[model samples]
Target: MHLERLVFILEVVGQKGRATVADICAQSDLPKPTAYRLVQDLVSSGLLESPARGSFAIGKRLRRITLSDYSDPALLEVIAPVLANAASAYGAAFFLSRLRGHWVEILHVATPETGVSYLHPGIGKRPLHACSCAKAIAAVSPELLSRDELKGQLRQYTEHTITNREDLAAELEAIRAKGYAECVEELERGISSVATTLTKTGAGSTVSIGATASVRVFTPATRNKIGKALSEMSQELSCALGWNDADAERICA
Candidate 1:
């Protein structure tokens, strides 16, 4: 009975973006009485929206649930403190981003108390090649973009940004080998970042720590330290996402 109702609901929405009880009953192959009762129940439970008259569509509650589940809060909680600590220690801003469709969206950011930085990405989308967080993830996950697509158009966000496809490809290869990426005022002058990819059970994500500093700040020694911390935080996040230690190590390492 529940399965039948679920199928009918999906079918109703599939046929029409919104539906009335009578319309759903006819399209879903259910009796009018059953369709009406189920639709009322779904609407009451906040799964369906009834804005005017008898029209119904998927509701905001369901939409929020879908987004929240996909961008799991439990996983974010595990990494938040790590980012905060990194930001505090380095006196910089740290960000965690995830690839959302064709864009990278910043999910979290931590700003340092000491440094006065101008750029704040906030919760917004950034171009794949323009930000260190996006590039770090893309470097390890070339499957994220098609070869032809990547080669076709690479925008230069700044003079130092990698606009050439061939050069960017080579840089990505190095990032993959070394398990980290760095942007030395490449996206904007006076801003630098070091980033690493985060993966869980074969699912890939990225986190970057950025500061208002010169290229000199990203010395080999500093990068090594940051890389170690980033690797640890990635592992913790992967575990929160249901990845076993072996899987987490393989993905983050």
Candidate 2:
């Protein structure tokens, strides 16, 4: 029964590309307790990973076994040099993020070998309304925000965080026009970050990359500089992943 349940759950995830425990329970007619326990065990064993609450994506073990085309595993490794270079050049920290199914989350971070650092946006989910990485990706792909409760329920991480849905929409429009997003004391009082979404989309997900540093160091002039740099990096990273400007343009169009 355990093996059968495991295989059935894997099949459901494979078919949906990603699936929630509820999805499994509904499809397989499995009891809630049975489905939840199996999914939890799979996630713990690296056979699955929960990218969002109640959402499961293939884990590293499965990716390796299937040689999946998704770049989640290799993304950070392939771009390590890029992130390190940018971080070193700016004397700050950099990170990568992704939106799969319906949510966006930080995947990795790169920091300068030695620098006068002020704050670091630790890896994992940050408030969507206050995170540059999440906003950059969500601006281009609004559907990614579907899994998040936005409507009038934006979380205010700091006083500077935008709590109004309309204001968030306006901010996203600006990000779309500027080709990047910035956070100034929004997520944290003295931490700032700049990010841009990869114009290219793949494997049913959108990718974003960004850098973070102290608010004092990321001043107006430095903010613009870092924002532009991240935009260019987004393009380069997208192109490297077998996607070109034309591909993204067609999708956006």
Candidate 3:
């Protein structure tokens, strides 16, 4: 009843990017007046915000709660230093990505001192097929990319981007076999990334640890080194997150 309506309203606002009371009512069977009242209540409670005069969006409080539940601060403390060390060592940018609802987004970043012309992609939803971070998780958790919304609809950011569904399917399979994913100028020209999925826990949050650099810098050996590093860090973090080897095999394998 009320609970369902609130969840539905949140979903509508989330999916629409910004949803108005009228927009929400139109999507659900709730009456216009009831929707308006509920929307106001949500805004008052800090779960939603009126970004525009009439449109509503996710609020600061909700985002905070989501982040806390999905990414523990203690774990992130360990992750941050790992990214900094990796970035410094490789002379590249190291990033941590996490699931936001159903979307995997860049959560944090550490960049090397010398790079101004590299690591252009910023914090936002990552392409499931083209991004090594997203692919790493999607390889283990296939349900995330198998949704109807993404089937055969992967956007091509560069010539190397895999747009074909069949090709992308094979790519995911390879990622599983390798235990890491590498993007060779797929998301952008000259920029490439290598990522591996974090070990899973019962909390249901999916994350990836990755490193990005200029194509010229990653060369063959450097790429392998970063890939190995990401894999090992991902494993350590996975253990700290509390799932055991048997559980990982059951859930991932």
| lDDT assessment of candidate 1 | 0.65
Q: List the candidate numbers ranked by lDDT, top first.
A: 3, 2, 1
User: Taking the tens digit of each residue's C-alpha lDDT, what string does model 1 give over 6-101?
Assistant: 655744542245668876665445788888888888778887788787888767777676543333354456667777776778766678776544
Model 2: CA > 4 A from native = 1-68, 100-102, 115-118, 145-148, 200-205, 245-253
Task: Go through the candidates in order and give the clash count of each.
Answer: 0, 0, 0
User: Per-candidate TM vs. native?
Assistant: 0.63, 0.70, 0.68
1-253 in candidate 3: lDDT tens per residue?
7997898788667645677888787666789999999999999999999888998988899988875323235456767887887777767788988654445778688887765545645777787888899888888787766677675558899999999878888998998887789999898888888998776434323678898888888887888888888877776666655544654555443
Would you list the clashing residue pairs of candidate 2?
none
**Preferred candidate (TM-score higher): 1 or 2:** 2
lDDT of candidate 3 at residue 36, scale 0 to 100: 93
Q: In order, what lDDT does every prediction score?
A: 0.65, 0.75, 0.76
Between prediction 2 and prediction 3, which has the larger TM-score?
Answer: 2
Put down candidate 2 lDDT per residue, 1-253, tens digits, no spaces.
6897897787667645678888777665689998999999999999899888889988889889977554455666567789888877788889987753334568678887765564566876665668898888778776645643455547777899998777888998898888889999887888888988777344322678888878888897898998999877766776676445665554434
Q: Return the number of clashes found in candidate 1.
A: 0
